[model samples]
Target: MTVYITNAKRTPVGVKDGIFSTIEAAHLAAPVIKTLADCSAVPPDEVILGNVTGPGGNIARLSALLAGLPQSVPGFTVDRQCSSGLEAIRLGAALVASGEAQHVIAGGCESSSTSLRPEKAVFSPQSIGDPEMGIAAEWLAEREEISRKDQDDYAVLSYRRFAESIAAARFTHEIVPVGGCSVDEAALKKRPIERMAPRAKSAFQPGGTVTALNASAFNDAACAVFMTSVEAPGMKVIASAASGADPNFPAASPVPAIEKLLMKTGLSVSDIDVWEINEAFAVKIIYTARKLGIPFEKINPDGGGLALGHPYGASGAMLVLRLFYGMQQRNERFGIAAVGSAGGIGVAMLFERV
Candidate 1:
């Protein structure tokens, strides 16, 4: 049994302090579900969502409610950090394959702007040190000998590729228009629709290569991909896998996930037509691609999380959606999408055009 992707779309990547910062996380997700429902003509009863930030009241249920899904419809929220979105799809695929569902929607969303801040350590507890994700990436860069220049170069390639893809209208078919005010309150007060665009200058490191031109800024966006047991004119999931590494070495986590995916699918790097590795940081992507023997040219042809902006939970599903679109445009057969998250978790999924 195969689970087919019927439709998919993602919100435009917004830079931090840019277009999305003003939007609420739940609001960000509503359009994605609405888009899926509108495009696939699927009812709300079949959808499930992945979310990481909101704790008490599951944002997935709230998002569905906000999307005007009937109260009788059931929705589940899942959290696997960065892998949440992809995992949601994995679960949906399994349910369909097992005959539990015929149609479903799975994806994720996040707003770093509203993420709850942890309380400060008052007593300097020895076992309670929780480092921010960026700091972890910095540590990984140092350990992997990945220079700032290399990171910036990779970022440049991502932006250039994304820009080229947009120019080619490669994403026009896949990206549905999100009609709503910008997340920014001020912007919303002025415009009916907020269009997001690339930044003019980089903000990561001054006089460095990781300019705004190639890196994704803090953004507020949502995306969803619809899956069904019914065959459609689209791609399907071949296999999916996730792995956990020692949080002490977060950057190296993706290798094991990719390895497991390859083993499960009995496929090699050469067998894949395209790769979408999340640019959690320059080193993580660079290291994983090099180890997997994936050609840079075949990797992230339409940009990646770094260039498109990482939306925490939504990124994994977004990667898979982009890979499906890429395969469709190229008339390719197979592709892989992977992402690394906090706590050294990683996920990888394989797809095939039917």
Candidate 2:
């Protein structure tokens, strides 16, 4: 009773202050879900969404309603930061595996444009003690002796790979077009039009290569994958697992999580034909690969969050969809998608062509 991804789609990764800034989170989500429904011909009885920001009343429910699913269909929202989308898929798979539901639409959506900056007024006492994500990455970078140069080089590689993929039209198949106000109205009306060009100057530390040209921008986007136990076509979820690590040292969490997944799947790193590791920061991926003894070439072949942008919640599920599509294109047999979150949470999933 394996749950398989019968269909999947994602909105284009919008650049920060780009065309997607005008779109709301739900507005981005509905289309992806609708596309999945239309393509798969599956009426999802439940929708589980991952979202971090909100005008919240069950963001999943609102997104489902916007997608035109039946009013009776229930929905739930999970917030595991970067791991939210993967958790949504994991939960949906569990429901299918447990016989609680046969059809489910599970994914995540995020509009970094809509996400609020942490203000002292709203920061909880707990948050006051928690390290900010960037600070956490910086700490890990120092601890791992990952020089700023290395981070910049990795970022550059990510963007170069992504730009190459775009030129090759590798992503054309997975991207769902969202007809919106033209780029002029969507981006230019609000800002100087010339600033909207594809490339930008370096914004990272002086002499650092993590420039605007290579890093992913904060943008609005949504992605969804239709899952079912009675799969008609597409890759199946072979196994999935989530693990937690020390919250303060969030960057290293993926290692243990992937270890558990490998053990659970009875497969070694070499057995995996593809690996998608969320690039919360360069150190996270580099460190995880070093710990696992996996080469950088073996991970994120087409780039990752560093290059494509991390919409926080939607990214995890989006990575899964990308891995599935990549494996299909390569005619590969196995793939793995892993994400590390802010609260020291990590999730990993193993997928195989059915």
Candidate 3:
């Protein structure tokens, strides 16, 4: 059986304490869910959402209810840190392909400004080293011998690409207006990236290459896609893979996951037309591209988390959403979305235009 993603949407990415600070994660997700459900014109049998810093409890259920779905339509939430959203979409594809459901809604949401900030959750055993995300990215860059200038250059490119996309209005249709903010907050707040990126001081370690300008910020947003077993004009789910790596180098997790996915599908790097590898850190893209021999231009052509802000769980789904629209615009045949989580875990999915 084949599963098709018929529709997808996301709320505007909001910077920390920016336009969406007062909104909750579920609420941010609700509008997007409602849009997808309404557009599909088919009540989803299940709704699954990936969330990182929600207000506890079942946020997927809350968001589903808030979207005015019938109580019979059950919902659940999953957490794999950064990869939560992609995992949810992968599960939705499984449900449709397995004949367990006719239609499903899956994605992720994050409200970093409003969500509780408890003590950090344990990602790996202490012996394995569970460094904070920034520290881990810093270490990964250092280990990969990535230079400060290279990371900063990548960061500048991300900002430039994002700004250019906004100017071209490429993202207009994919965004669902919420919180009275139609534009992504980070897009508006972007400083003179070219000038600041070079002078930005190290954010994690003294003299460390990783800096605030080159790393993604905590953001609030939500994204989801409608999946169905029935054939349609949309991207078809080809395959998915989940893999793990050293906890201390969580940013590099996507490398193994994408490798596993390619191995599973028996496809090579050149076969993929577009790549949506999460840009939590510039090093993530640098390392993955270098390892996989993928061209830099093919990855996140609309910019990535570095410029748009990373809304944790939702950022993963954002990758799919971008791929869906991007492939359509460019008339591409194959695309892939890959995300690395905080716990040395990664998820990658392949999609082909149907």
Candidate 4:
């Protein structure tokens, strides 16, 4: 059995303590989940959501109830750090393939502005000290010989791409309006990219290449996709895989994860039409693309996390949502969505345009 996404939607990424600050994590997801089912015209049998910073409990269950899903609809939460959203989707697909479910809603949600800070030390076994995401990216940039200038340039380009899209109202189709906040708050939409990109202060270490500007903003957002074993119109998942690595260098995890999928499917890098690698940091995409021998032009044509924000769990799902629209717009065929998680984990899935 093949699982197919029949509908997908995401809240505009909001800045911490910004548009979505007053909303709780589950509440943030209610509208998206509800609309996903509404648009799919197929009620979900289960709801699976990925969350990292929300208050403890089954956020998926709460969100499902809040979305007005049937009382019999059971839901659960998955915590895989940055890969949580995509992990949820993988789980949902397995359920469909294993005869566990006919229809499922799976994605992620995060209200970082109101959620408690996550315990970084617990992310990995104590050998490697817990380093902040920005710090890890800086280390990777230095290790890979990616320059401050390159990272900054990439960040600016991401913002520019998003800005162009916003001007054309390109995201109107996928974004769910909430709190009257339709505009993406994290992208420097009001500012010129050239002026703001170079002036951002280094946030993690002194003299570090990763700056507050180049790194993804910690954000609040939610995303949901309705998937079923029945085929869909535009896209269908073809392959999926996950891998784990040394927790200290989490940024490098996506390479093995993507390779694992390709290896499983007997496909090569050249077979993919579009690559959606989450820009957790500019270095994340930069290193992963170079390692995979993929051209920059083929990656993130509409911008990524850096331009908008990293709403933690929501990012992975957002990547797939972006790829869905990108491939549709380009008349493309095969695409991949991949993300590196905090515990040195990687998740990647290959999708073909139907």
Best by TM-score: 3
lDDT of 3 by residue, 148-191 (tens): 99899999999999999999999999889997889999778748
Write model 1 residue lDDT over 1-354, tens digit each, in one string.
Answer: 888987887776555546666667788788878778776565744566666664446788788788887777688888777788888888888888888888888888877766663332222123643455555566666666776667767766776676666557676665544544423222222211112222334344343333343334555567788888888878888888889886755666788998999999888889998988877666777778777777788888887776567776788888888877778888999988887766777788889987
Local distance difference test, candidate 4: 0.87
The global Cα lDDT (0 to 1) of model 1 is: 0.71
Clashes of each: 5, 0, 0, 0
- Arranged by TM-score, best first: 3, 4, 2, 1
Per-candidate TM-scores read: 0.85, 0.88, 0.99, 0.97
The residue ranges of model 2 lying beyond 4 angstroms of the native Cα positions read: 116-129, 181-216
By summed lDDT, which 10 consecutive residues of candidate 3 come out lowest? 113-122
User: Which prediction has more favorable TM-score, 2 or 3?
Assistant: 3
Top candidate, metric lDDT: 3
* Cα RMSD of predicted structure 2: 4.5
Lowest lDDT 10-mer window, candidate 2?
184-193
Q: Over the stretch 144-248, how does candidate 2's per-residue lDDT look in tens digits? A: 787656666677677667666766778767777776532211122232212322244435444333344333456567888888989666788889888978676
Q: Model 4, which residues run further than 4 Å from truth? A: 118-121
RMSD of 4: 1.4
Tens-place lDDT per residue, model 4, 190-212, is 86768877887788888888887
